[model samples]
Structure formats: C-alpha cells, structure tokens
Target: MNKKSNAVLRLIGILLLTIAFCVLGYLNAKNIKLGLDLNGGVSITYQTVEENPTAEQMSDTVYKLQMKAQSYSTEAQVYQEGKNRINIDIPGATDANEILAELGEPGTLQFADEDGNVLLTGDDVKTATAGMTNQNNNREYVIELHFTEAGATKFAEATKNNVGKRIFIIYNNEVISSPNVKEAITGGQASISPIESYEQAQKIASTIRIGALPVSLTELRSNVIGATLGAEAISTSLQAAAIGIALVMLFMLCVYRIPGLAASLALFMYVGLEMVLMQAFEVTLTLPGIAGIILSIGMAVDANVIIFTRIKEEIGAGNSVEKAIKSGFEKALSAILDGNITTLIAAAVLYIRGSGTVKGFATTLAIGIIISLITALFVTRGLLTAFFALGATNPKLYGIKKETKVINFIGFRRIAYSISSLVIIVGFIFLAMNKKNTGDIFNYDLDFKGGSSTTITFDKDLSMMEIDSEVIPLFTAATGGNASTQAAKVAGTNEVIIKTRTMTTEERTKLYDSLQEKFSISEDKIVTENISGAVSTEMKKDAVWALLIAIFCMLIYIWIRFTDIKFASASVMALSHDVLITVTFYAVLRWAVGSNFIACILTIVGYSINATIVIFDRIRENLHNGSKKKGLEYVVNEAISSTVTRSINTSLTTFISVFVLYIFGVSSIRDFTLPLMVGIVAGAWSSVCIAGPLWFDFVILSKRKKEQLSKK
Candidate 1:
C-alpha cells in the first residue's frame, strides 16, 4: 500500500475499533454486575444456633449459602461474618422478606415414607442440580440427586423395598415432593422428575443444597437497601467521573497540545474498552470498584504524561517529532512498566486473598490496570502516530520541554525525613489518645464491630442526606452521642435500615419514640436486631497476610527488575510511609473504618509504589546514563528534579478525580474518596521526597563502607 493508503487504512481501522468497542460496551452494559453498595440489595446475616461452631461447619454453611444466594443474583456474595455468622449480600434485590422466605430455614433434609418411616437424611446427599430431561417427547425439569457412598447403599435398599410406594423428600419438616419409586435402582444417583418449570426445579435444587450446611442458623439481621439509592449513587458517580475526566482531558490538551488531545481520545477508548471487558468477564462493580476505575484513569493519564514529557524533552533537544516520539516512548517505558506492574502485583494479591467487597475492588482495579496499559502503551501511541501522519506534528504543537535544573533533594533529605517522622509520630499519639478515649485505636464502623440494626418503613422515601441530617441526630441525641450510625435506604420502598453500636432496651425504646414522633412511623413498621460484623476477625487476619504477601512480591519484583536491593528497600519504605501516613489521617480524623478501609489502604499502596517506581526508574536510568560518574548525590538529585513535573501532574490528576468523587458522592463514598485523596498527596510526597533520598543514603553509606574496606 502507498503511504497515503496506509494512513487512510490506519485511520479507518481506528474508527472501526472505536465503533466496535462502543457497540459491544453498549450491548453488554446490562450484563455488568453491580454490587450491594451500588445496586441496593438485601444483606442478610445468619447466626449459627450451635455454640462455637467449627471452622469446617462455618465453611460448609458459607458454601451452601453462596449457592443458594446465586439464585437471587449470580453476583451474590456469601461469606462468614465474625465467628458464628454467615452474611449474604444480593445486589439489585428489593424484597428482603421474599428473599428470606426463598432462602428457607437451615433445617435438615430427610427422605421419609408416607407411613412416617424415616429413610435417609441430607448427610447422604453429595450434590443436587436442576436440569431438563426428555420425557414423552417433551422437556421436563428434574432435580438430579447424587448420594454419598453410605447413603447410596441405604437408598438403594430402601428403593428396592419401597418399589411402587411413595417416598417424600422432606425439608425443614415440610414435604417438598413425594415421588413413587418406579423400580429398584442400584445406582447412587436418582432423579425426581415431572416437576414444574425450571424455576421450580431450581427452587428444589436450592432447598436440597441448603441441607449441605452442617449447622442450623437463625436470622440475625436482614437489611433491604433501596434500588433507587443505588441508582442515585451510580448516577452521581458517573456525573462526577464525567466532570473529573473532562477536566483532566482539558488540562492534558492545554498542556501537551496534540499529544494531550490524542491521550484524551485514548482515555475515552480506555473507558469504553474497560466497560466492555468488565461485562465480558462478568466482573462485579461495587461503589469502591467505581473508585478503582476512576483512580486507574488517573494512572492512565500519568503514564501518558510521563511519555509526553519525555517526548517534549527530546524535542527541546532539537530532535524531529518522529524521533522524539520514538525516544520519548523508549525513555518512559521503564517508569510506566515498573509503576503499573507494582500496582498490578498488589491488585493480584488482593484478588487472591481478599473477600467480598475487597475482591470486588481488586477486580475493578486489576481490570483497570490491564486496560490502562493497553490504552497508554498502544492506543495512545497509535493515535499520536495517526495524528503525526495527518500532518499535525509541529514540534511547537507538542510543546517544548525546557531543561530542568537539578534540585538538591539529597541535601534536603533530613527535612523530608523529619517531617515524615513527625507526622507518623503524631499519628501514633493520636492513636493512643483515641484508644484511651474510645477504647479503640481507630473508629470502627458496623463492618468491623457488631451493631444493632434497625429497619424502619417510613411514610415516604428519604434521601441519604435526610437520613444523615435528620434521622441520625435522633439516635445520637437519644444515645448521648455515644452511638455511631450508618443507614441505607431500601430499594423500591420508603424503608431505611440504620445500624449503630449495640443498643440497650432503654436506648431502643427512646429511639422508637423519637422515630414515632419525628417520622410518625408505627412500631409494626420497625424491626431491630443485633448484627455481627460483616468483616470477621478471621477475614481481617487474611487481609493482613495479603498485604504482607503483596509487599513481599513487590520487593522481589523491584529487586529483580532494578537489580538493586536498596531500590526495592527504599520503595518498600516509601510504600510503608504512605500507608502509615494514610492511617494517621484516618486516626486523627476518626473516619469510620469500614470494609472500604482495606481497599483504601491497598489503593494507596498501589499509588505509592507507582509514584516510587517513577522516581526510582529515573534514578536507575541516570545512574547508568553517565550521571553515575558525578557520584550518587548528583545522580539522585538530578533524577528527582527531572521527574518532579511528571510526579506532580500525575498526582494532581489523580487527586482531582478523587476530590470530585468526595464532592459528589454519598457519605459512604465520601469516606472512601476522602482518605484516597489524602493518600494520593501522601504517595506523591513520599515518591518525590522520601523514596529517592532513602536510596541516596543507602548508596552513600555503601560507598563509605567500600572506601573504608579499601584502606584496610
């Protein structure tokens, strides 16, 4: 093909890809799963009646509940809550009572004769599934049952003797079905056929499956969150995201000109591609997941900014636009790769080890990272090349990168170190004070600590703001400000569920009277129950282990890639610094530490490591590229100064995105985004001020030791 033909074909290909992505994204958009926090759903907690349930029993129960909850939504989450409780979260569900009724009682499954002769129990059952079988030239739904070895033998004997007699499948003392034995079956598997529709078959299958739980459970609490609330949350989040992204794109265009415009186009494609991928992979998007997507968008911008800045630098050195583009990408590759890979490491660990909402956050984050890499490395590069082919490749249009004067970062290392130390120390002091004052190091929300959940059906639907400003104050006043409350509106209803610290009878009565007086709600419309923490102690232990593994993995990766233990150590130190500083913010501000806390910390780690890697990449590059002859101080200082603009631009874009989230989001989202914003700023500071200096000191000390060894 001729050059003009190739350019036309490339442009045509880009347009076709864009259109295809949009079509796929739009078509599969409905398949995108929303989590409980996004699409208000039923959150039911069940407590085992047996005291001190074994871990095996808890695991079995959770597994059974997970299977049962999948009937409501495939994205339903069932996990252990605290020690002896199981919590099921079904998103986009409104009817709590209906769900509970369908979930049924955690009772035994038994096979009995019409004469009340007991045959076999659920313990004999290995698995039960619903499927269609051909019968009399028509498809009929059937429940296929597979029994255990012992159960199979017993069932075979019973069927042999009870041929032509009715055998009932009983669950929770209720007869589900009574099928006549046709013939003596020697096989362990049996089919209960000629049932109703597929839905009925599914219901029967679910009932049989529920019998897999080892222990009986009673409802501890059931919360119905309104779908309208979820819709509102999603709408506002999108609005915020659109506004934030527009601002970022505008900033990019104004600063980097043509490259910025190309980046903006790539970013748009990035979002569309991510949505399509999420739908294709059946990834569940929670509120925190949305936060992850927005955060990753910032990272995408960061990558492009790094490359564009390098390109500008090459242009400033009198290189042709094509040469600058090639050189810029080459120079920026290490920083982008190291930064994104470190974040991906954390995300992978989180997905492997984290549970429920944390996993949701990780899924979005991981997907975002992978998609961002595609857009940054390929899509952005292609667009820039296409723009160049279209004759818009003036060096001035790409902006000239002025030479950056080296800043003496190593000399000011002490000030940065002291500032970080002072902040962390003050955070410790705050933790101590908080411990003494509240009997906890940090403020724990309902997810961490068990609480009293009050479900109220109001006369009309109330917004979250009204619930916070109007209803929460009633509880606070009644409890003398000792109660920390969180509320969610039930979808498709005027019901709101409020959770707070365990309430006394007097406090409950007081709350009742206040609700009756203020909202004119009847006692019948209100339900109160004590609920266990959604994030159990065991899960918290798992989170700690996951974080440790993530850090260790990152350390190994950096050491291998950069070929320097000091660089890895300094990066880890900066990561630790960022996390600790964020914790301090949570401690001092007393932000409600809920399930999102783990996600917040993980995000900071990812953000911090990425920032650290950028500076480290520069330092490594400088060290090898003739700057090492000037000594470690000059190399470190020059690296920090050269990459400072990229660091600031990336941080600013990320901060703005999260800041917009805080401004437009609900209280829960605000809590998540606020800490995230703080972490972004903290990560940037640590990367520019902390990580580089720490590495410099390591090198300086190593050099001094080598000199001493030479003298010896």
Candidate 2:
C-alpha cells in the first residue's frame, strides 16, 4: 500500500476505536454508581453501647451491618468509624426515617424454649433470607435461617426433647415470633412460615442479621440527603467540564495545530475509556471523584503538552519532524514516568488506607492516571504518526522554540525561601489566633467538627439554588458561620435539612422562629439533633497515614530513579512548601476544612511532586550530559530554565480546568476547586523556585560537611 493509503487505514482504525469506546461509555454512563452526595441517600451512624468495643466486635458489627444494608441497595457501604462507631451509607435511598425504622435497633437475638431455656443465640446463625412459599394456591411469607454446626446439633437435641413445643425467637428481649416444632429438627436450616407479609418477614430477617452483631448499637445520627444538590452538581459539573474540554481543545489546536488535533482525539478516547473502565470496576463516583476525572483530564493534557513541547524543541534544534517526534517522546519518558508513578503511588496508598469518599476519589484518580498515561503514550503517538505519514509535517504547524538564556533561579533562592517562609509563618500565626479566639483553627465544617442538623418541613418547595441563596444564609446568620442545606428527596415533601455548627438551645429556638417568620413554618415541623462528624477520627488517622506512606514511597522512588538522595530530599521539601502554603490559604481565608480537605492536600502532595520530579529529571539529564562541570548552580539553573515552559504551560492548563469548575460549579464544588487552584500555583512555584535551588543547597552542604570531616 502507498503511504497515503496506509495513513488512511490507520486513521480509520483510530476513528473506529474512538467511536466504539464513546458509544460504550454513553450506553453505560448510567451504570456508573454515584455516591450519596450525588445520588441522595441515607447516612446513618451507630455507636456501640460498649465504651471500648473490641476490634473483633467492631468488625463483626460492621460486616453484619454491611450485609443488612446491601439488602436495601447493592451499593451500600458500611465501615467502622471510631472505636465504637459504625457508619452506614446507602445511596439511592430517600426517607431516612423509614430506613432507620426498617433497619431496627441492633441488639441480641436468642431462640428459647417455651420454658424460657435458651437454645441458640444470634452468633450461631450464619445468614437469614426472607422468601415466600406457595401452598394450596396461597402465598405465605417465610423467614429462612441457616445455622452453624454447633447450633444445628444443639437445635436437634432441643427439638428432639421438646417436640410439638413452641420455640420463641426473641430479639432485643422482645418476643418477635413463636413457632412450634412439629418434630425433631436435625438440619442446619429452619423456616418460620405463614408470616403476614413479605415486608414483615424481611424485617425479621434484617433484625436477625443485625442481631448477629457482637456489639449492641444505638443510632447516633441519621442524614437524609436530597437529590437536588447532587442533580445540580452533576449538571453544572458536566457543563463546566464540557466547557473546559472545549477550551483546552481550542487552546491546543491554536498552539500546536495538528498535534493538538491528535491530542484532542486522544482526550476523547481517554474520557470514553475512563467511563467504561469505571463502570467495569464499579467505582463509585462522588463529587471529589468527578474532580479527580476533570483534574486527570488536565493531566492528560499535560502529558500531551510535555511531549509536544519537547518535539518543538527538537524541531527547533533543526531536526527532521519524524526524528523530532521520536526523540521528543524518548526524552519525555523519564519525566512522564516519574511524575505519573509518584501519583499512582499516592493513589494506591489512599485506596488501601482511605474509606468512603476518599477511596472513591483515589479509585477514579488511579484509573485516570493510568488511562491518561496510555492515551498520551500510545493513542496520541499513533495519531501523530498517521498524521505525519499523511504529509502534514510542516515545522511551522508545531512551532519552533527560540534560543533562550539560562535563568539563574538559584541566585533568587534566598528571596523565594523568604517569601515562602513568610507566607507559612503568617498562616501559622493566624491559626494560633483563631484557635485562641474561637477554640478552633481553620473553620471546621460539619464534615469535620460535627454539628447540629435541623430538618424543617417548609410550606412550599424550593430548588437547590433557591435554598442555597435564601434559606442557608438565614441559618448561617443564625449560627454565626457557614451552613449547609439539603432538600428532602421524598416525593410530595417540602422538607429541607439545614446543618450548621452545633448551636445552643437559644440559638436553635431563634433559628426556628426565623424560619417560622420567613417561610411560615410551624414550630412543630422543626426537628433538631446534634450529629457527629462524618469524617471520623479513624478516617483522619487513615488519611494522615496514607499521606505519610505515599510521600515516603515517592521519596524512595525519586532517590532510586535520580540516583541521589538530595534530589528526593529536595523534592520532599518542595512538596512540604506547597502543602504549607496551601494550608496557609486555608487558614487565612478560613476555608471550611471538611472532607475535601484531605483530597486537596493529597492532591497537592501528588501534584507538587510531579512538577518537582520534572525539574529533577531535567537536572539529572543535564548532569548526565556533563553539564555539572559548570557548577551545581548552573546545572540547576539550566534545568529550571529549560523546563520552565513545560512547567508553566502544564500548570496553566490544569489551573484552567479547575478554574472553570470553580467558576461554574455549585458552592460545594467551588469549595473544593478554590484551594486546589492555590495548590496548583503553589506546586508550580515551588517546583520552579524551590526544588532545584534546594537541591543546589543540599549539594553545597554535603561538600562542606565532607571537607570539614577530611580536615578533622
């Protein structure tokens, strides 16, 4: 075949693959499970009656609760919170009261003879299932129970001695059922038949399952999340993402022309494949998870940007277009691998240690990073190659880099260090002042600090936007700080739940009066309760451990890859700088340090390290090519100078994606993206100004130490 014909065939194959994935993604989009925040659901926490529950007890309770919850929805998740708390999240559920009612109070279950002799406890039961039996054209609900070997043997002896006697099933010290034994029952399974209804039988089954828990549980708090916020969030997020993708595509096309077109196509494939993979993996998509996808979109663009920039440099060095393309990819490999691998490590750690939304975010992020790497490395390459073969190989289309002098980033290190230290110091000062004044540093939202949840049945229905603009402000004003609102998801209900910092009785009464005065709500319609933080102490500890482990792993990887501890040390220092600065923004602005805080901080850790590694990779390259003879200062400066464009462009593209999300997203999303924006800028700044200079300082100190040791 001719070159043109082969190119056409490759292009056709690319088009086919893109279409296939896009079609699959579109068809399976609904199959992607949305989180409670996005789908509206019930979030309930149960506290063990025991003050210090054993780990085995907690684990058993969590497992039983998970099985019970899964009966309601397969996507249900039950996880241990603190030592004595178990949290159940059932998405796609409305009416928290109904769910709580059906879930029942978890306590002991016992099967006793009519003489009140205990025969079996819940611990002997393996599982319970509610079913129906047809007899003589009549359907009767039944609760089937399967028992352990010991329970089966015990039941056989009991039934053999007490044939035709009634056996009472007691749950929580209440007689739930009494079934007569017709004969000796030897099998491990038994059924209670002729129940009134399936719901009743199912209730019994659920009770039995929960009763199997080793620890008794009391309801601590229950939240009925409305679908409105999620609907608005999803809609607006999609809009923002679409606009951001279009903007990115336009920017890429305007800058790199043909290669940009190739990248845009690869981006499409990336999204399509991401959706398919997420569905395949059954990864739950939360708001932060969406942020992960969009951020990865930016990162996907970053990989392309890195390669295209290198290709331009190669072409600018007067190489042929085809050779430049190959050389550019080869040269960009290490930075790309190091950056991506570090992020993957973070994601893996988070997935392993984190729970709930944190796990969700980690899963999506890990998948996105993998897919982005593949698309950028393979799909983009194939498209570029086919385009090249089809005769679109003008250097002008890709643009040539002009010769530029090396910037002395090292000379400005002192100023950079001073500025960073000033910002961080001011942040700490503010934190101290806030702690002294309010007894807390960084405004803790309901997700972190626990708060009062007030459910109000208003006279008229209100949309999420209206509630945000009108109702939540009143609550915030009453509470003297931030407040969150959720409309009830139940049909024909005009209820809205408002959450704020824990309030006094007087404050609650005042807020109730305000609501009555404004919306003419009845005093009886308002219900209030104090709820604990959703981000439990255990989760916080897990996040910290995940971050610590991720950083340690990344440091080791960078040390091995660069063959120097200084590069890894310098990179970690730069990461610390970005994190502290971003936290400074949070403290100064008093951004609500909520669940998204963990995601934001971890993201900065991953992002800052990626940028730092890029610079370090360049420095390693320069040193390998014997650029170190000029001096460590020159080597660092030249590396920073050479990669400055890539750093700025990558940061800007990522920033643009997140910026648009902030601009167009709902309040919750804005809360997430704002700090992310700060972190991105901080990451870029530290990578450029901090990492290289810090490495230079490290080398200088090492030499001084060696000289002193030798002299001594």
Candidate 3:
C-alpha cells in the first residue's frame, strides 16, 4: 500500500470535512427532537365507521368531512388516523364538538311502504355505488343500488306497480326528494334523479347507494387526554438524554483519549446525518421513533470500532504511518457495511408492516442505519484516511502502539458460555413467573383489550372529582356497564381516557349514549369505536410474526453473505442474548418503576442485534483473509481488535444520541430511551466481548482439535 503524498493527503481532507459537520451538530444539539410517545402525549385516532363502507370510501368521506367541518370552523388539521380513524388535532378547541357535527351530518335513508309507513331504515342498506347515464333525454349522475337481495327485491316490487307514482327518498327522517320510476329494474339496482350538485349527487349516491352495517358501532373508548403527564414526560426525557450523551463522551475520553476525541467528533457528524436522513425519508418521530435515533447512536459506534481496530492493526503490521491508515480502513470497510446492512434489512421489513409506533421505530432505525453506514464507512474512514495523508506520523502522537493486537479472547469461553446460559435461563423464568403481571398477558392494554378513549381538552383545567363522578361513571354505565379505568389520564386537567377490558357492539353503543349525556355533546358527537376480538388477535399475530421473520431473515443474510454457518449462528445467538437481556431489564424496571416496558424491550432488541451483526461481519473478514501461520487464534484476535474501535465509537455515539434523548427528550421517551441506553451498553459489550470472541473460542478452536485428533 502506498504511504506517500497524494493518497495520504486525500485522507486528511475527508477527515476534516467530517469534523466540520460534528462541529455544526454540537452547536445544534439543543434543537434535536423527542417524540410524543416518549414524552407522554396522547395520540388519538378518530375513524368514522364504515357505516358499511370500504377503507377508500371512508377516507374519501373524511376528506370531504374535514373540508365541510372546517367550513364551520378553521381549527381542524386532519390526518389519516389508525385504520379508519381520522385524526383531527384542533388547537384550543376543547369542545371537539362542532368538528363532529360537520362529520356526522346524518345520511339516514328511511324507506317507507305504500301507505308511507316505514319498511326499513338506512340501517338495512350495507353500501351503494354510483355512475352517470342519460335518463329520459336528461343527463343525470345516476345512483346505483347494491343491496342485500332482500332489500333489492322489496324495492323492485314496490316500484314495479308504481312506475309513474312519486317515490320519496327521505334521509335523516326528512324527505330528500321524490322521483317517478319510468321502469322497474331488478338485480339489486336502482337510481335517483335531480340530486344537488355533481358532488352532492355523488355523496348522496354513495351514501344512499350502500348497504347497512351488520351492527351499529358505539364508542367504547373516549376521553380527553390529560396534558399533565405530557408536560412532565417532556421534562424527564430531555434531562436523561443529556446526561447519557455526556457520560458516553466522558467514558470515550477516559479510554481512548486522542482516538476517543476523534470518535466523538465523528459521533456528532453521525447525529447530523441521521436527522437529515429522517427528514429526507419523512420518518415520523414518535416515542419509538426517538428510541431508534438514540439506538442508532450505538450502531454508528460499531462502524467506528471497525475502523479504529483496523487502524490499530495496520500499525502493528509494520506499515508506515500513512500506509497503516489506508490499509486499516480498507480492511475494515467490508465489515462495517456488512453489519449495519443486516440490521438495516430488519428495519426495512419492520417499516413495511408496522403501524403506529412500530413504524416509527423502523423508520428512525432505518435512517440511523443509512447514516451510520455513511459516517462510519465514508465520513469517519475518509477523515482518518485523510489524517494519515496530511503527513502526521507520530505513532505516539496518534496513540498507535507497539503491541495493541496481542490481546487474547479465545481462552475465556467457559466463563462467557456459563454467564450467557444463566442470563438466558433467568430471563425465561422471570418472564414465565410474572407473565400474569405483564401487559396483554395479564392485564392487557386497550390496544389488545379492544376499547376506545377520548381525551377532552377543555379551554381550561377541570376537576378530576367532577369528571370521575360525572363523566367516567356515565361512560362506565354506558361501556359494557362494567366501566373500569385501567389507567386514567394521569396527565391531569380536563383530559382523561376511559377503558374497559371488554365490550360487545351493543354494550359499546349504550356506553356512547351515556357519555353523550354526561359530556354535554349531541348523541352524534359521542362517536363510537368498536374493537373486535378477531382483529385484535390478528394484529397480535402479525406483530409476533413480523419480529420473528425479521430475525430469521437476518440469520439467513449473515450465513449467505459470509458463506459460513458458524458465523451466522453466533450472530443469531448474540442477538437472542440482546433481546433476552433487554426483556429481563424491562421486567425488572416495570416491576419496580411502572414505565412502559414493552417499548424498551423492542427498542433494545433492534439496537443490540444491529451491534452484534456489525461486529460479526468484521470478524468474518479476518477469518477469510488474514495470514494463516498465526492461526485461527490470531485471526480472531485480529478481527476483534480491528473492529473494536468502530464498535466503541458506534456504541458511544449511539449512546450519546440516546443519552440526549433520555435527558432532554421527555418522560414518554424515557420509558423507551433509558432502557434503550442500557441495552446499547449491553449490546456493545455482548457484540465485542461476547459474540465476537465466542465464535473463535468455540467454533474455531473446536475445528482445530477435531483435526488434530483425526490425524491419529
């Protein structure tokens, strides 16, 4: 490798550029964001029921409703809320009343018999579709009927003999219009004429054209969100994130000194890059979203480890200062990309299927992966590469050592194996023993329990006593009549969330009717949201399957990319460790400090696994390419040392970002950010000390012994 002028100079230029970005980020740390989930803000999704309509139809209705509603007032910002819910964030509109009235303009179609007696109601029609045609030489937007053949046949018989008689179309218990039927049409088809505008004609055609819902939906969960907790959460996370970042930086300086400073500088760039990626990709920064960013800090350190270790190795390999810098990065590049790439694949899979907070995790994680790779591979490596190019050749000055690559990890297998086994076993036992106390398993959250919550934010604060005595009790009598509050909006104010462990469709309706009376809203304003057991079960299954599949996909990727089973197996095992340890931590935390534990576990799983994979990717290279005389032991040592700094740097930077979130972020974020911070530390330790070394001690050494014994 050339150690001279041009090649070395290029390396210096890149390093300086990366350094500049870090300077910029450090200056802007105060502006970084923390998601609401981490900070305890209520995220409510209000979906208008299908009323026997499709998702597309419901969305269309919501779009129009928002415009119509806004016409009444301009305070509504509409978004596509969960499933079919419409999210309307109205600033200062505590009533949330006028918004509902605009959305729920009743389109009930009352079907009357020959003597004008009602035969059925809009409740009987499931759905309707509309189109255009020329009727009796007049062009009209024709509404077509798709009814339950029963609804269709009765209408056909009624219209067959009354071809020229006026057939009244009463909606909302009022006569909309009456048109004489020119012909009797069968096969569940019908048309109405002289409708309002083309838009209104389409609306009426679609509304009156459809069939009825199987059962009326009532709001089972509705309550004003408490702003009190949100404020507290905001205060808590920001402080934790700040403390965490400072601690990691302090540790790096203590351990690596000059190199540590360089890595920290690199870390700053990583954060800046990560934010740009998140915005460029349009990732929503939710509670789990902050977890991803903070966790990414760890993964980013992993790349730094790879490069730092390689730099150390090249120096040991007897290269000139410049040559060593170039070679170290060249050797470590493949490993850095391989590791981050694998975790990246998992993040991608998650984003595609995960909804709500899950999507947030995947999105931020994926962004972290991309930027982590960029900084570690290009920015950090290029900067280091440039540093050597600038003619700075004091091995002592840069902290290059005479004996850095001689550490042995293969001899510590017994201890590692024993400790790992104990941790895994303890985790399983703890999970099993306390399964009943855990959420969903024991006292599931409303997500699985199938309920609704409405957070009413008054223009001013209200008394909890009044709400409990009036609002909650009214809803309790309405929601399954066994109204229970799993967790009221601990965030005080006029806000609250009402919940029930279970409620059927009828029970939900009755609950809504009761709340309408108590909240002083029209019956229509008390919108209903029903949660079905089947849908809940499916969502549960999907969540589990998605995680498992992500793990499996990652396993196969490591095996195929590295062309070895041992490497992949070790990686999978280490990942399993990260996940289990995370869960154990969560259980202990939740058991002790009542935080949202599951988010922490999931965030840890993703963070740790990414670290392990990156380290393993680097180790595989030393196995395949390093000189053989030094044997597997040397190769393993070389691999670990070569990637060690990258790991440390990645982990440190990731922790720094996480620390920032934990401190400066919010309470909602702390539940996730704090655990994630712990998990990052654990994940780093496991990947370097556990996963990387274990592979050589067991598989590499075992193969050598079998060969020796077979020689006989």
In order, the Cα lDDT scores of the candidates are 0.84, 0.83, 0.56
Report, for all candidates in order, the number of backbone clashes.
6, 0, 74
Which regions of candidate 3 deviate over 4 angstroms? 1-266, 385-391, 404-408, 435-536, 588-599, 614-619, 625-667, 688-712
When 2 and 3 are scored with TM-score, the better candidate is 2
State the local distance difference test value for candidate 3: 0.56
lDDT of 3 at 433: 62
Question: Candidate 2 lDDT, tens digit per residue, 624-684?
Answer: 8999899888889989998898889889888889999999998888889999999999999
TM-score of 1: 0.80
Prediction RMSDs, each to the true structure: 8.2, 9.7, 12.5
CA error at residue 349 for candidate 1, angstroms: 1.6
Per-residue lDDT of candidate 1, residues 1-712 (tens digit): 7656676677678767877897888787878877776666788888889889998778667766766776666457665655787878798766778888878768998999879888998878877878898878999999888888998998999899899999998998899889899998778999988888988988888888888668999999787765424467788999989988998999899989999998998888888898898887778677777877887887779889999999999999999999999999999998899888887888899877665555666777888888888888888888888778878778999999888899999999999999999999999999999999989998988778768878898989788768767988998987789666766786667888777887889999998999999988789998887766666665677688888998999999999999989999999999899999999999998988988898899888887788788888988888779989998889999889988998899899888898888899876788889999889989999999999999988988888999999999
Scored against the true structure, residue 172 in model 1 reaches a CA lDDT of: 81
Off by over 4 Å in 1: 43-87, 93-214, 218-225, 228-230, 457-473, 480-484, 489-495, 521-525, 706-712
lDDT of 3 by residue, 261-320 (tens): 666667777766765555455444444444555555555566666566556656766777
Cα lDDT over the full model 1: 0.84
Residue 142 displacement (Å), model 2: 32
